[model samples]
Target: MTNTILGNISFENLAREKAEYPRLHMLKPESFKHIEIKNFEKVEKEISFEIGYHRGRKRWCLDIYTHRGIRCDGEIKFFSSIPAIREFIRKEYQREPILPAFNQKSATSNFNI
Candidate 1:
């Protein structure tokens, strides 16, 4: 099934869970040597969110390091009436769209069909 196939993907497996709160791990700083991220930058805006439109009552924050791939992104939700941030984070992690896989074999084909 499509869900089974998708669940097998690495990114889906990396999705966080509510019980995984306070998730913290140190990444090798060298991985980010090529990308520059200044402090106080808003990285999640580059992604997507449904915050604010429902009301001025929702907020979320994300911290990211460009090199360790999607695993480096951290999310935090802010609101008194909603589910914990970890829940939303896990959902986002699983649903984040990814580029299609590349196929070198297909790239070499020149047939017009």
Candidate 2:
């Protein structure tokens, strides 16, 4: 996949589109899963979120990939207001979670038990 910098676009345009035109942020690889969001975190300086699907041995996890390259696993509590989502993004970016890939292979290897 290509890495597109969010810095190339205007935040106002992204925010307006995210607010007015709700869309499903499909996980990467296209076949993983689809998540619908009526309202999304408004894009801002030094802040961005990535949506992707993670596969485990027994189940799949929907993860939010942060700008810091950390993936926050499990269910996400979405916010309807732009400001709220923005704040969540800020805080989450600070405490970035490790990507599930670290444990994926181990989980599958031990699945026969």
Cα lDDT tens digits, model 1, 2-51, are 11221112111124442221212222211112322459663432333322
Candidate 1 Cα lDDT to native: 0.29
Give per-model CA RMSD.
Answer: 16.0, 19.4
lDDT, residue 110, model 1:
27
Candidate 1 segments exceeding 4 Å error: 1-77, 81-83, 95-113
Clashing pairs in 1: none
Error of 2 at 64 (Å): 2.5
Q: What are the lDDT figures for the candidates, one per model?
A: 0.29, 0.31
| Predicted structure 2, TM vs. truth | 0.25
Model 2 spans with C-alpha error above 4 angstroms: 1-21, 24-72, 95-113
Candidate 2 per-residue C-alpha lDDT over 4-110 given as tens digits, one digit per residue, 9 for 90 to 100: 22222111114543432222233321112223333684433222243322222222223343232253333445444333443554475544322222232322332
TM-score, every prediction = 0.18, 0.25
Error at 87, model 2, angstroms:
0.8
Error of 2 at 83 (Å): 2.8
| Candidate 2: Cα lDDT at 79 | 46
